[model samples]
Target chain A: MKSSIQRVKAIVFDTFGTVVDWRGSIIRDLSAWGECEGVKADWAALADKWRGRYEPEKDRVRTGEIAWTNLDELHAHALDQVLAELDLEALSVDHRRHINRVWHRLEGWPDAVEGLTRIKRRYVIGPLSNGNVALLVNMAKHAGLPWDNVFSCELFRHYKPHPETYLGVCRLMYLDPAEVMMCAAHNGDLAAARAAGLKTAFIPRPTEHGPGQKTDLEPTQDWDVVANDVIELAERVGA
Target chain B: MKSSIQRVKAIVFDTFGTVVDWRGSIIRDLSAWGECEGVKADWAALADKWRGRYEPEKDRVRTGEIAWTNLDELHAHALDQVLAELDLEALSVDHRRHINRVWHRLEGWPDAVEGLTRIKRRYVIGPLSNGNVALLVNMAKHAGLPWDNVFSCELFRHYKPHPETYLGVCRLMYLDPAEVMMCAAHNGDLAAARAAGLKTAFIPRPTEHGPGQKTDLEPTQDWDVVANDVIELAERVGA
Candidate 1:
């Protein structure tokens, strides 16, 4: 019998923390910008707090408490609150715009490009991210990611962990859920993928939230495949 | 003063005959297969008849006569009708499946990949075709087209030249219609894009409908940029 791994006709990834290091990239981007602009603040703290606000901010739209908002707006809104909280409010509009777009310029993990490139030869590959379509496209161009397509929550008007998102990518491809694989660093994401009748792969991004991060250090369950990083995931998938 | 061409942040394409030589490709593929299988038929006539059915079949979904059927279903349905009309029906299941997939395996016009690759360096590029997402993705992979992403009418559940389809792509990109350029060989497609407020590029594939093709030989309107081919498109776009 063919293995379930061989059944994955396409693979969709959770981009932030899984494929790109959002925390490190954002902190680095803001710190460099601050130094250039002669602005002083705890950039790392801002990154952390802004990311902390993300779940709550995203939840508002996810639960219909707020109107559908894309990631760019969510990030910009969260950035404002985090900046005010950190006493670094009153940024120039241009500076704020640059900082918010840092998400669009997030650097992919070391193995991301090579691994995805290899896997792409066999199965269709893309980012099923909460990022808006423009953000995903810009990120792909910036990171040199050769995604077959970009799946934005904006496309479905539904956030991840919502079954709509997990299955939406499959629906667009005219694929059965069983033929799709969801790859993510976060176990919760993989759990949702499995619950939605898709296969799963866990590739831990241990430093996703920076060196002190303790969560998502390893796969919490028996995902279809567990690999050290994207490179290993590519190898395990026999690409 | 910046020309409207300079305002284009992303470019979307009409794929079938614009980016790929669908008529020649389908004819060549079916003819070669027929030769190998010792089945004789007028492959060119079949190709033309099949393409002739495309617009009407697609218009069914566009006009809401049928529920949102994707391109794959529409193509398969049309192919069956063309096959019966040409007295070439009753092929084996696998043979029929292979014939149906010729669209996904289309070869790009001679300059398509190189030109699009150059253009992509300056702006995001994708196919804004009536083809479904899977079809676009597979075509890109097969043709070595380095698209930043794939756009399909299936995503919007509306077909061209519907206003919703044109605006939906801009909406997902968070861009004003004027910031997006629609590049196509068909004058009618360009007219639709122009009316929808997108900047337009016309690159003539003079033989897109084969040697007898007369339509879209020269752009009927003063398009934003009229190029010899995609190669000239890359140059005119200043990529």
Candidate 2:
């Protein structure tokens, strides 16, 4: 472990792909729902396309093209567009509403709960994701993630890669930047946290974007700690 | 149970006296420390004096006499005045700092943990206290309070009786005011919550201020529900 890990008092995680398997969970959940409803459509391609829209939505908020919209609203609006693109307009408004909430029902990766419970024993653990407060709170309850608190971009009114999201967690928790570790699966997220002066830990989820995923399969820079999954990340950090 | 109880999807609590016995905890902890350090002082009197300073400190912030200061800072500032008044200047700065965190180390009431856990299984449960985020988080860890999330005056930048503090919890959780119930031992807090459009539950802690406690001995208004303790409150609300 890096010497900086010894100073860490809290660990904030990226939720979407790091703590929870958004891609696989959404694909599996929506596919099962569609089959049960007799609403045939290409669930996998729709899932990927919908996930692709998340960045653009965040960019609009970051660049000031749009006001601070919570992730739940962004996800709902994006789901509407993708449903139309996939010619699934036959799904009712209520159906679309429930479908968009698949993000809230996303399941944790196999090691997520065990790892978080362990790290939580030693440090303040929470989700510092771009997801809104309600979405992250619901997700934690659904997935049994033992977060000490849930920190969301909605609370800071700034998305990931923004300095406020990284620093806000430290400010609210009364810890210095170096005393808070930003643990995530995405290289971009960790790079931003590093730039914001927080310790960084990389946990690569190679199948996060599905087996064909080509990016973020390894640590792109010298993060303070790098592990194959959250469980190993906990052990490596001496949690 | 009243029909309003059925509408409550979330329950937020007051921390100091409602869930935890601050008076008892601080008096015992500080007296033990005083004995170990070969110091002599009225621990009970000091505890009462420090708590009495809390309202004036909050009044200063709420009236714009000072900027938005968090509870930890307010507590530290109050401790300075009380220490001088009681002539306890022999303690080191480091000792004072650790001593001020007794608020974070407060133990929950006998039924607090079990009651909160029961309510949590049925509805979202959290602390919507004037305490700062770090204080409440540390207190929960110390007392084993299983909150789904923690809300604080620091998050809203407003203290209790301010409509913002009462309604902020609902807004953050994406619920209507009626969907959230404010549970407290203090009648003033529940009155403010009711005025702010939230459902209210009163669980009078008659012994919170020690056996001589007089105020808030009974429900002052027709609150949505009233009970003797949190365990009864949980049952009254049909949790």
Candidate 3:
């Protein structure tokens, strides 16, 4: 296999499940808020169900089923749908808005911050997520992820797994795709980036969807580098 | 005068002279490169002349006289014009491209890194410059500016001193204009930002255009905050 590691100058990440523990953070946040509001359901189930709506809503924008919308707005829309689905429509608008911002308050993986800090010293490191710019920026501040920059679907007006989002970052950085590495916890995200001529690194987040998660537990394809976590990924990159 | 300092949640900066020393850095880079290539000219004069074309070229884009183009392309166009004007056409194309990237390798002002690091503890900080996204991102990496996010004219598709660029950042951050402060070394940049309803801070860059720089050496308007440098600006902002 060709070692493209030496050629990589920038590493852009998929933020949600890669850098931040969105599933656990959201479940804890909503469960606490739900208890206070006297609303009860299988909170973990709701968390999983809520996340299940994420990509489909974004797909609405990607496929032009809806107008171009940001991830926060999409999350809000998806939240409403899930609330109605669970028969919990009594949640107030202000509460709903606050809950929608849970994505911004996500806790980073234990190694995310220090690993990113180390790798940042050697390469330009930043989020290349489907999240909006404000969401990613706020999360970086909240989680202490020292990103050199923030790239978002809002910047490209295209959702990830789409070629535009992947290629647009390279265009913005004035770099060839091979010189940029797309690092993610999801095998699918890495596969898409690799197909787009970019270098790829996969780090499995087996519990990203909770302990029973069946997919993305291992690199499904031959990725450029597969590490245990960001810390190991940083070591692999010689940072 | 109203004290809007307490209301500010984010601070966006005008980068060129405010944060990075473009003139000195470019002059030093090109002078060393020129010596190596056996090229000869008054490089300082060329640097000043090249900077003189900066706004007018962006103005062409702003006015639709030229199609929307990135700062790198505009810089290249300006460099070609200056090279022709100075009769220094013997420089190779590769070397000229390297010279154009000098903007990316600019050194930060003496107080820029520490002051920004201090202020960032209390606020969201980033460049709101007319430079493209990659340029600002590269400069932050080059100078250790510790920006929480990177904003650019390329994101808004509008140049600074334009309402769109100022208002665009507020839109991305989901912030009211009053809650975001525009900080710059240039009063005109502050003036433009203020007219758009944002708070403004001016920190004079006396030697931005070299020691004898005559303009923007002091605040000409009743800016919301006036400080000697970013360190003082951070103090005024309660960081």
Candidate 4:
């Protein structure tokens, strides 16, 4: 809600569907892998359901309803349940690991690399994601995403929406929260970042959940900046 | 001594003086800043002396000979002594901070960026420096060094050649020691890394200490790969 543009020095992103097209990328990747491995299932549905578990599972740990767990752990747990529900037979640990790494091979949105390159010329740009450090690192390498650093929930042992998740990045970068901006396609993410005293930029990812995506179809709250895409966001922020 | 290159998946560099010419960069930066600020001193000598303090000071913290200190604190300690020796009068905290950040604006060796980019295409290339995370991150940005992550001694709260420094990187990256190679211009650093079971590559910076530099002019110990420069190192490593 505030336009204190001069205060921001770094911008952290929500990675899953904002910087990268997780839904479409995962569907294509997993489908190809499934075809190669001769394993068949409704991977699109499974990918959506897997993402759906991300928040609730993370909330369980964050709210102390369950023990603290990393995104990798939560993903594994969700993967087990979904695989069982899909009537997939027992798989080896190696196979599970390979499948879990599908998250690491995500393709960036078309504008992601170019916009981030422009933004990097001006400010520090990195992902503040629920993903682990290794996952984010591999994804950056795979997708050619030019990140100044990879700030992950793995660093703080806490997931996003937790104030520590945002504040931990500021601490690591040695910057004040006010000097760091959180840009996400999710309103809840920006809301959390705003409440944590960090500036917020929202870019709607209407198709984040595919055609029937209902929530986060539009900006739900007033943010410091709202852009049509990463390119526009960079231009608007003078990056 | 071991030529077992099969296990090394990532190669992390020691940033200051190893990957980048810290002495040259700092001396030049500080000398220019001194001229601008109407201050005078033996900037080159001071830069060299400050670099010299790095190991002995870290050894003090690492071996419990002195209290544990982060790089920023150690840098401040060295700064105070160097300032007195240079006979600089009282300066404001802002001025001191600006001077301290000479470390963040280091220039990489001629082959640093191109070699690193090549290596990065084949391996997870990052900095495992004694520099604090923010300092390393900023240095990378300023120098256009392509690093997948900035793994600093600050993360482990222990400076090299501490085993924890090497082990912590592997732990964070989810890789075994054999899966990570420690690449450095200094033999002492490679010695410690090899002792800790990590693979080693030596790319000598004979002039790191400026004219008449003696030590680390040649690989004192057998390193897995000995290259004259980073580009040669990249080629030797099949990057």
Candidate with top DockQ is 3
lDDT assessment of candidate 1: 0.89
DockQ of each: 0.82, 0.73, 0.89, 0.73
Where model 1 places Cα greater than 4 Å from the true spot, the runs are: B92-94
Off by over 4 Å in 2: none
TM-score for chain B of each model, two decimals = 0.96, 0.98, 0.96, 0.95
Candidate 3 residue A126 C-alpha distance from true site, Å: 1.1
Model 1, B86-160: lDDT tens digits are 777877778777888888989999999999999999998999999988889888989999999888888888888
lDDT of 4 at B224: 90
Off by over 4 Å in 4: A1-3, A65-68, B1-3, B64-68
- The segments of candidate 3 whose C-alpha lies over 4 angstroms from its true place after superposition are A32-41
lDDT per residue for candidate 1 within A1-239, as digits (tens), equals 13977778899999999999898888888788888899899888888898999899999997888899998999999988888898777888888898899998999998999999999999899999898998999899999988988987788989989999988888887789999999999999999999999999999888888878899988899999998988888889889
lDDT of 2 by residue, A1-239 (tens): 66767889999999999999998898899889988888788888988999999899889888999999999889888988998899887889889888988888999999999999998888888999999888999999899999989888888999989999999998888899999999999999999999999999999888989878999988989999988888898898888
lDDT, residue A239, candidate 4:
79
| Candidate 2 structure lDDT | 0.91
Q: What TM-score goes with each of the models?
A: 0.95, 0.96, 0.97, 0.95
**lDDT comparison, 3 vs 4, better candidate:** 3
Let me know the DockQ for model 2.
0.73
Docking class of 2: medium
